[model samples]
Target: MQQKIAVLGPGSWGTALAKSLVENGHDVRLWSHKEEPVQEINNKHTNEAYLKGIELPKELKATSNMAEAVADVDAVLFVVPTKAIRSVAKQLVAVLETKPVIIHASKGFEQETHKRISEILEEEIPSEKRQNVVVLSGPSHAEELAVRDITTVTAACEDLEQAKYVQDLFMNDYFRIYTNTDVLGVETGAALKNIIALGSGAIHGLGFGDNAKAALMTRGLAEISRLGVAMGADPLTFIGLSGVGDLIVTCTSVHSRNWRAGDLLGKGHNLDEILENMGMIVEGVSTTKAAYELAQDLNVDMPITETIYNVIYKGQDVKEAVRQLMLREGRSE
Candidate 1:
């Protein structure tokens, strides 16, 4: 069966997913707040600014009008940034006319509220307007997905059937989807891994070998699981795709903005300089603060997260911060 889907946000990930939907024979309309990319995607069948050199399918259309893009769609996907999600959800409910399956591919908690993405959706979108929100997340990167790389991800919702529905919508030969009922675990894992990715990139930038990164990632997963379990998430979900899988890919991939940002920081560049140069959102930078705060509130001992927070926010020297981390009291693994 064909579905009419509206993808809100024309960033690299959003554009890539929209392109995939087009190839899957769906009536896909991508909503972009900016008219420049809208015009470019509709006219040239390309989003050069985001997915450079990739030609989007002619069937994939884009619109600046949010209401028009989602007018009669079967599903509406929010692919915008974390900072913009609440605003976008507010805008969606204002124009949404039917009960559509609401989905979000964006990761990271709201820095102010420390709320997960679905929590924000639930707060903003009335239950009368939609079913439960679904989260699509994993190690998949937009750059690779745009070029049809083999990618796997998880679609999580409290309702198993809803997750299966999404799994069917996205699964293809090159793109695989798994369903999980652990929304809390999946969302937390997806957002928290970015912090570790930053740590791994800093390790790489400091000229450390693979052994150090492996240790950071391994310990980072332990920290993530600790906080996650404290917040009532399934312990086993930490080893699943949205958890360890996301951590591995983001920490090591060249396509990770968080890793790139951390690399620059490790090389002595400030956050302002790195952000200006990257021209993309490094989610981990903000997530580090949010996770750090959450950890403090939960009384969870996350040493690596604490160290990264001090280095990034307190302007502590990266090497000195690392030295302090190394000198901390050893604990049983």
Candidate 2:
């Protein structure tokens, strides 16, 4: 069963996902906003700017024309950055036909808007097909995914059948998929975990050990669950693939752009220097600001998120932030 799929954004995650679907025998039309990435994919079957070492499937057609990208597609996979989803979704309105089932692979809440990626999509996509929205999230990283490393993830949607459809379309011997109904929980977990991963990386960069990292990861989850539950999500969803699962992988992996950014910050490099050098989107960087503001607005207690916010935006010393975190009143877990 060959399905025509449209994948927007040609960054690491977007390219990896397009490759994954293409290898599974789907006809994938991948759209890149930049002409260079599109040319590399169409002519050489590679995304030089992002997934450099991996070869993309020849069947994965690359297009700069949005209409050509979405034409006759059975499904659309959105892999753009959180901050960029709104504008991309707005543009998609012009190219789309009968609305395709939309799957979002992004993992952060919009900072100024405080809206989830799916939320932004809902506004741009028709209301009649809102339930068609599905979120694919877990511990999947683009680099390993490109090399065919075994990966597992959860697909969440309000419609069980829709979730299963996505699970069937992408799952393979190397990739296992699970389905759940808690879309909000899954998306929130994926977005919020970036905040804590940065904290763990900061501790790691400051010459900390496993104990410190563990404490941050554990307590960090408590905050994520608190916010999720408050926002009408199923509480148990936080324990699932998108929550604790993604949290662990992002916090521990050296490949996480968010954590690596924090590591440089903890080691004394400024945010401007780190961003200029990385030349990529660190979802956790802006997400920290967004989550901190969200916690305050919702009256949620997220100490770790707050302190990191101070270090990054308030220009507080990283060591002082660490000391302040330790000096806070200790309570029983």
Candidate 3:
């Protein structure tokens, strides 16, 4: 069934998803806060800053007005940064007249409260104006998916029916979606993997061999699983697409902002300088702080995350942090 969908973000991921939905025959209205991108998307059918060298579907519409985007839409996909969720949700509430399936694709937690993206959404959007909220996440990158790369992601919601509904809405020959009922597991995995990716890039920057990178990825999953389970996520979810799958891709791919930022850090650049150069949000930097605090509160043993936190926030040397990680007491695998 063809439906009207509003994609609430004009970043690479948001534009890629909107393009996919248009290809799937859905009427897509991509919302952007900036008028330049909105005009570029509607008039030129391109988001040059976010998705360069990629042509968007001409049928995809865009607007700066949130009311026009959410009005009469069957679903609204929130694709903004983690910090922006509350503000966007509050604006959404003012205009949303009827309930629509709320799907969020962004990953990360609220730095202040340490709440997941889904939790933030539920807290902001009233129950009467929203149906079940779903999370779409995995290893897929916007650059690859924009070019029609075969990608698989998980649609997670507590309600299986809602997950399946989202699965049907996004599934295509190039883009495949699976349904999972473990929303916490999926969301936790999605948020935490970025920290690991940061570590992975640091390993590469420090001139570490493949063995070191492999070790980082492996042990990173262990700590990620530990924190996830402590937060009520299923252990098995870590091995799924949103867990280890997302970790591997984000850590290894040059397209990942977190990995790229970490790479600059490893090459001896400061956080402020790296952020200035990257010109995008590297979620892991913020996520590292949130996960570090959460792990401490939960009494979870996340040495990797702790070390990364110190390196990023405490001004510790990256090489020194790696040495400390290696010198820690060994535990059984």
Instruction: Tell me the TM-score of each prediction against the true structure.
Output: 0.99, 0.98, 0.99
lDDT at residue 49 of model 2 (Cα atoms) = 77
Least well predicted 10-residue stretch by lDDT in candidate 3 = 273-282
TM-score of 2: 0.98
Candidate 2 root-mean-square deviation in Å: 1.2
**Cα RMSD for candidates in order:** 0.7, 1.2, 0.7
Clashing residue pairs for model 1: none
- Residue 26 CA displacement from its true place in model 1, Å: 0.7
Per-candidate count of clashing residue pairs (backbone under 3 Å): 0, 0, 0
**Candidate 2, which ten residues in sequence have the lowest lDDT sum?**
123-132
41-90: candidate 1 lDDT, tens digit per residue: 99999998889999999999999998999988889899999999999999
In candidate 2, list every pair of residues with a backbone clash: none
Off by over 4 Å in 1: none
Candidate 1 vs candidate 2: the TM-score winner is: 1
Candidate 3 similarity to native, TM-score: 0.99
Q: Model 2 residue 324 lDDT?
A: 90
- Reference-based lDDT, each prediction: 0.93, 0.89, 0.93
